[model samples]
Target: MTVGSTPPKTLYQALFNKRMLICICTGFSSGLPLYLLIQFIPAWLRSFDVDLSTIGLINLVLFPYTWKFIWSPLVDRFVPPFLGRRRGWMLITQLGLLLAIASLALYDPTTNLTKIIWTVAIIAFLSATQDIVIDAARREILPDDELGAGNGFYAQAYRIASFVPGSLGLILVGFYPWSVAHLSIAAFMLVGIVTTLLMSESSKPSEVPHTLKSAVIDPFKEFFDRDGWQSAVWILLFIIFYKLGDSMATALETPFFLDMGFSTVEVGTVAKISKTIGATVGTILGGVVMIKLGINKSLWIFGVFQIVSILGYVALSIVGYNYLMLAVASGFEYFGVGLGSVALIAFMAKSTSRLFTATQFALLSSLAAVPRTFISAGTGYIIEAVGYTQFFLICFACAIPGMLMLFKIAPWNSQKTAVEETIAE
Candidate 1:
């Protein structure tokens, strides 16, 4: 099979498989709590007349995401006391997230800012932990041939989960008290709990590291050993910079819309319709195209859309207060993001060795999140200093380094593995 050739599988055969269904569950289970923290909480705080600087500093509470790799070895080292390795941790974290999210409503963000910060931090921690197990499970269960399509479905499911909080939760806030809205959002974690109970565990005791030292040290050693240290470094840098610009640009998106003089109803309605539909279509299209385009070409094609999407933000900043412009810009942004995410996720899945699936995926994903967690903390100051228009232009420029790295990491004509080469026929 050539890199540009399509596989012989029918569309029905591609979409209707056991592994793909698992990908959907993984995506939904992993995305919900994250959307709550990143989307719902910021809007909730901003609605209470919180200053932009304080709201920006509140992002610091999400630092757990960037450091999740530190504790991932423990997950790899020890199985849960109850369920098997992956399922056990999935159940534990899902339950913890439910309790944490429900409890968030008890403290008023206005009067209990400190409590809110601490509580939300715990939610972020649990959410990050859940992501590690889910990502590992997805990697283990999916066949190599299904990586691109499976990850595309996974990204789509993740985006769909966001509609629950980003759309429904936001709408509820306008009518009900914030507490009611929060509990409503928390109830949705039931989906993840049900999924955990129903799905089979992916990891067996023999497959993972038996000792803590082996769990902690072997994944790192194996990664650096597979290729020369130089190539490994380039791969790590590519992961870090690829999503950096996009993450920072959208870090304060909900707040940015509100600041642009859009009403909550307007933002919520627009996001519900535009982002949901656009991202869904883009994700499916990205996945299907990836079957023929291969990950390398998909990255190049999607990178163009990703760069163009940043300009949508720049357009929104210029147009100011027009809902029509808001809809167009946000819709394009979501579509581009969804396509780019499919490619990046497939690449990550391809990169990991099965023996170190949990640890290595966690490490890579955690590095990818650094811009969102740490660098994004300063976004409020940047917007305050340079204003929205200039901030977006700066983000567009920042995206170039990652695209440049693609020349070395995933060249346009490169067929990375025999699996990809065969699948392309």
Candidate 2:
């Protein structure tokens, strides 16, 4: 079957539907364990005085999170008994996430690095698999008219994970010692457990490709048909570095705050509360604006704001210990990230073919995390040699290569044609 478009759903329906709410909740679930496996884990380890490179190396456990597209097909094509396809996979993977994270709480990163890494690797893998199912369901279940709104709702939930897990986890680590923080991290995974058990999958997708080859071959064929290797290159580059500067700056946040004479309590309180508040507001605002202004226009606007948010870090470096600067910069950056990220995600969600939803979304979304991976990988070395000021400047420069290459990678021309075609269809 070919791609088809339906008229947009009403505002009321988009906001209130049971399936839509479930889709949004599960989207949050998909990201919950990821913080433990990637973001918060490093900070926790760092608290124990674990070497920075070790923290960076532990990040490799998350390769699965960034590469799960290779195996999303198995989940899409297979099913479990009692529960339907997506639901069953979601249930099983959520259980795995719960177990892995709980076990992580039990291991001592200093004394048991190997065991800790193994458990985290398992959790990251399961989390990525859950992403495959949940992302496909969110994209497919919504009517064509509602993809943007649905994406908005889903964005709200997903960024909540981004905020709550990382920022709050830091606070948890600050308030308690390492052992207690691990347990708190485990308890946080319960959010996913509750969400998966409570939420039902959407109706079996009418457009889901029925056979192996269609699901296997059609998505790639259609993707290339729409935009060639150059478009793919642009998207891939953006995914890998759109936020490289910000992310590089982000990786050193806890250290920088500590160096600047802020107490753990201060960093935890400001980063946690500010990020949660900003991202929540930013997500809802982004979604609403996407609907009103239209997705295509919103992308450019949101993207510029994303780039600008890096200035917040630059702001922090320039004005140290000023709470006002801290608050504005923290809030604005988190908000911009939340708003911009949803636009990027919704755009990716729209591009997937039914047969290849999981694979394509996995590829694009995985690419989304590539920036974090690159930043996390070398954050240790950067922080060690260069002070925060110079490091942030270097990080800021990484944006240039990607932004300059945007035309070659995802040219405005293709985005324009794609929008026009959608409107015509």
Candidate 3:
């Protein structure tokens, strides 16, 4: 086949590719620490008879994720004596996560609520740090064309890692002591630790920032310089708004399900399982289509599904209490969002300059998280004002602005130009 008309790899070759294996490792390692913080820690607290409000308040510990960009520059600047810059920080953060997670088991949340908060907060910080490095590594290692497929595998493996803390770890609670369960979870960090030792550092030593100030200042400076003021602003705004509506729509999900008269078990079991399956399928399909259609077109297509999926929640809100309907709605939402996320991540990866990969990627990814971190707080009030059906309808409307912005930031025909530029480089 001609270079431009090369046939796609067979499924076996695609799945067994070396870089794909590294992507899986990166996803699992990056996911485990965060899941331990969100899923396992909350379950651990509830098991100790902690009140719902206290548990909710404790979730504020996840604030580090929103602010991780501040420290991410340091990740771009320094390297440890041994491993290269990316792997060095990855090793440290992964080790810290391992210790911080296990340390949680040492505290009893009922009696040591303050202590538990401190420990889990450390876990969050370490987890966020790990994310910065892992993301940079993924960006650096994958070629321009592979970003979508690489991130698709990353997303799928991330979901699988969630099962460790969300499902298996919780199941272990029934059969084992909390300490043992926490220790077992800690042991899983070894998956990352070993992966770090085995895999070659994705970034080169020469790419390390020459000075710390440049690390902080130049990532921002270079972004604006390359894209210019107007385009840079558009990119930032697009990142913030692209996922906003879906983020808002799902913020009050558990409560919404409960209010619709579905039991917690249905939400916990059926919704979660079906969503996982749908997400896996959607991510894989998105990766394949992205390879064929390229990032710009994939963004337009995946984005439409994202907006359409919000209406599923509206349908579920009206249908009420049907387990089958819940599964269908939740599943489609997950699938659609998964597709959008793969394209979005690939776009962000492509946008970054390799020298500032960690800091720029962190800033962009952090901006994408704003709606989830801040706007989600107001979702309950919005739902209170206009019941579930109308709230989701509002979300469907909110998604439009981002889709419109795609023409400005990632125009449909731009993908071909982007590929041509990559070829020139």
Candidate 4:
């Protein structure tokens, strides 16, 4: 099937298949711990008198999410026994995360931030690596028109992960003793490891190239040598700037909520119900919009919406923490995110040459969080520098690059012809 057109395959064929189900389950399992360490953990630490500046600086541990592309080529080119291409690497990384999370549970951050940071970093790194592998598997397996719907499912699972750990866990932490909360989260990690082990590998191990020269060396040369590098560069910038607005708002959410005197239950209520519902509704809406409008125009609409929603955070800083106000703004931002994300993923999928699908997709998708990860690492510092309102505004401003780059790529996004790709410079 062509990248732009609907695939002839049926949705039932993809859904009933065991492989896709495993991909969905494993993807969600691997996804759960992310916000636990990045957003929630930092906020928890602050209650112990952890400095905001320190929290901001310590977020550098998340650098792996941004840099995972460096090793994506390794995953694309190598495979282990028992599992093939994507699945083998998936198991390895997921197992590694299980160990990392357990290690963090054993080390109390109040007592030892040093050890906790290292363990969190380890989990984040492995998780990012696992995402690259799983994404490659989905792109290879799913039908074209179904890609939008598949992304919807992926977001659903990811939002659940975010919800369970962030919302449910937070609710427990507020009511129960620390021991209970830590033990509960650790138990969840154990279940995740078992689920990963029991699932079948998505793709079978096949011989690609035996040597470093063939596997790692040749793909890079061809990707750059063929002059595909220019489009890839533009893509990187778009990804880097796409989520700046929402991210800036999000970076301060926990603190903002706390400052406003909302209990953990209130935050959890949003996570489990409102935020989760918004994400789900937004994803469905995004998939339909993409299908109706097509990738190019949807890119414009969604990208613009993404930036505009940053204004909601500014409103929150002004209006204070009313539940209704929070719900409406969160809905706008997260929903916008869900929509824009579908467009970006589909667009990136269209950009790949089929032969290099695994490597190229990894590179593109990992860049998805570059802006979020980059700005967020310094989130505390930025919060300190300009304070919350200005930070949101700055993030809103950062989104301009998405349009600028998209316009430059308009030719490429519009027509994927050799003639278009090779215009005289």
Candidate 5:
């Protein structure tokens, strides 16, 4: 089939396939520990009276996410003794995450702040490593045509996984000791373990990267050689800035709700529920829309939605303390996040060579994560300096450069040359 022609499968058939189911499992596994770091841990710190600046500084621990590309070559080059390359790494990291998450219960944030930070850092490292394997595996299994719906389902499952540490963990802490809550959340890693055991390894590339040096050097060499240095630089910049605005806006999300005088229950039940519903509907809708519109147009349209959604946070800042407004704002913002993230992920997956899937996707995604880790660390300072209303406006402004770059890298009328080439092959 040509790239210009409609896919033979219906949406239902596309979504119900084994590949999509695997996407769901891998997505859930990939998302859980990260949310536990970004959502649950921050809330835990705040509850123990950790100041905003300190809590914000904790985002620095997530530096591993931004740097995971450095070690991705190891994952790409070496297979563990048990499962094949991808699933082997997945099993190892998932197991490490389970242990690291549960270890968070061993310290009190007040007295053992150093210990907590180190443990959270370890979780972030494991989570980042796990994401490398999962992204490569998903890319290998999904064909070019299926990238949109496949990544949509993956992104959906990713957002759904947030409900565990983001929403349910918050509520659980209300009834149980922090230790019990931490352990309970840790148990969820079993889902990934089971999925890893049952799922077949994705088809390997015909030619593997024979040495660690080749794994490290060749992905970069191929990407630059393929696009030329100038276009490749533009693509990397877009990867960094595309989601910058929304990412900064939500950097201290749990803390933002608390600062706005919402109780943990209110944040957990109302705000999270609304956000999850909006994200779920938006991702599913975005996936379907991509099937019709193609990824380039979807990026243009969804980029607008993402930019506009930051205004909801500004509105909440203006109104203050109203549950209806909170729900509306949170839901709207994440709905846009869902739309933008789905397209971006599909774009990243499309950008990689299957032979260098793990290393290339890791480099692309790690660049994508730079804002969330480095720039977001300053958000607490920004919030204190400018207050919520202006901070969000700045965030809204941060998104504009990325949209403009789309003109260069992902122009609205551009052909899907990469996917067409893959189809020809």
Candidate 6:
């Protein structure tokens, strides 16, 4: 099937398939550890009276996520003794994450800060590695036409998994010892391991990279050679800039809420509700819409929603401390994020060669993470300098460059047949 062409499956048929089931598992497994690091851990540290600076520095451990592509070739080149290549790595990384997360229960942040940091770092590494194999596996298993819906399901499940660590884990900590909460969360890795065991390995590439050097070098070479350097550069730049504004706008969302005089309970309750409902609805709806609109058009339309969502924050900044507005703005922002993320992921999946799936997807996704990991770090300074209203305006402006680049990278009328033709060469 051509990349741009939709399959004739009904919405029910599209969503009910085994492939979408796997997408759900892939997303939940991939999201859990990352959220554990970003959401649960910070709260854990603060509960123990760890200094804000130390807690902030802990974010640096997530550098593994942005550099996972560097080691992705290792995953691509080496198959484990069992479960074939993709499933083998998925199982290994999930197991490692399980053990590492449970190990956090053994150390007190007050007394064993260094050990805790190192353990979290190891978890981050394992989580990032898991993402590489899972992404490649998803790409291999889904048909070209299913990329939009498949990734939409994945995005929804990813957001749902955040609730485990972000909400459930925190609630557990209140009623139980930190150890129990840690172990409870760790036990959730069993879901991933079970999914790995149940899933057959995705179809193997016709030509697997024979050596580490080839694995590392050839994926980059293949991507650049596919459409020449100019197109490749445009795609990379779009990946970086597409979500840059939204990411920066929400960099310190909890602080922003607090600054607006919302209590912790109000912020947590409202955000969890809004994010769950909004992101869930957005992804599922986006998936169904992409069936008709195609990824190219979805990008253009959803890109507009992304820009408008930032303006919602801008409105909130001006209105200040209104609960209804907070809920509306937060929900709308997550909805936009969901739509944009699903479309972007489908585009990235479509861009990769199956032979280089792991490495290429890793590189593309790492570039997407750059805005969140690095550029968002400066948001605090920007907000301090210009205030929230102005900062959001700047974020709104940052989103436009990416949308403009879409005219070249993913034009509204462009057909994926051209991309398929390039890969066929």
Write out the backbone clash pairs for model 1.
none
Give Cα distance to truth, residue 14, candidate 4, Å: 4.7
lDDT of 3 by residue, 8-117 (tens): 76767655678888899889998887767655675677557564445555656677787899999887887888788888888999999889888877887768889888
| Per-candidate local distance difference test | 0.84, 0.69, 0.79, 0.68, 0.88, 0.82
lDDT of 2 at 388: 69
RMSD of every candidate to native, in Å, equals: 4.0, 4.0, 4.0, 3.9, 3.1, 3.8
- Using TM-score, give the best candidate's number: 5
**Candidate 5 lDDT for residue 141:** 87
Off by over 4 Å in 2: 1-10, 203-212, 406-425
- Name model 1 segments beyond 4 Å from true: 1-14, 417-425
Whole-structure CA lDDT of model 2: 0.69
List clashing residue pairs in candidate 2: 8-145, 234-409
Best by lDDT: 5
Residue 36 in model 1: shift from native, Å?
Answer: 1.0
lDDT of 5: 0.88
lDDT of 2 at 269: 74
- Worst 10-residue lDDT window for candidate 5 reads 416-425
| Ranking of predictions according to TM-score | 5, 1, 4, 6, 2, 3
Q: How many angstroms is residue 42 displaced in model 4 relative to the true structure, after the best TM-score fit?
A: 2.1
Give one clash count per candidate, in the order shown: 0, 2, 0, 1, 0, 0
Off by over 4 Å in 4: 1-11, 14-19, 143-146, 189-195, 411-425
TM-score per prediction, in order, is 0.93, 0.87, 0.84, 0.88, 0.94, 0.87
lDDT of 4 by residue, 1-425 (tens): 56899556676875566555654575576567776765567657766768777777666787787777678777766777756666677768877776666565565667888887887788878888888777777766676655655666776677667776667777887888554565566566554456557765555445455666665666556556565677556656676666666666676577666656666677777634666676677677877787677776777888888788778777876787688877777677777777777777777666665566666666666677765566677778877787777877887887777776666755335643231254332
lDDT of 1 by residue, 53-76 (tens): 888888888987888989999987
Which parts of model 3 have CA positions greater than 4 angstroms off? 1-15, 37-60, 106-113, 170-184, 252-268, 318-320, 380-391, 413-425
lDDT of 4 at 236: 60
In candidate 1, position 162 carries an lDDT of 91
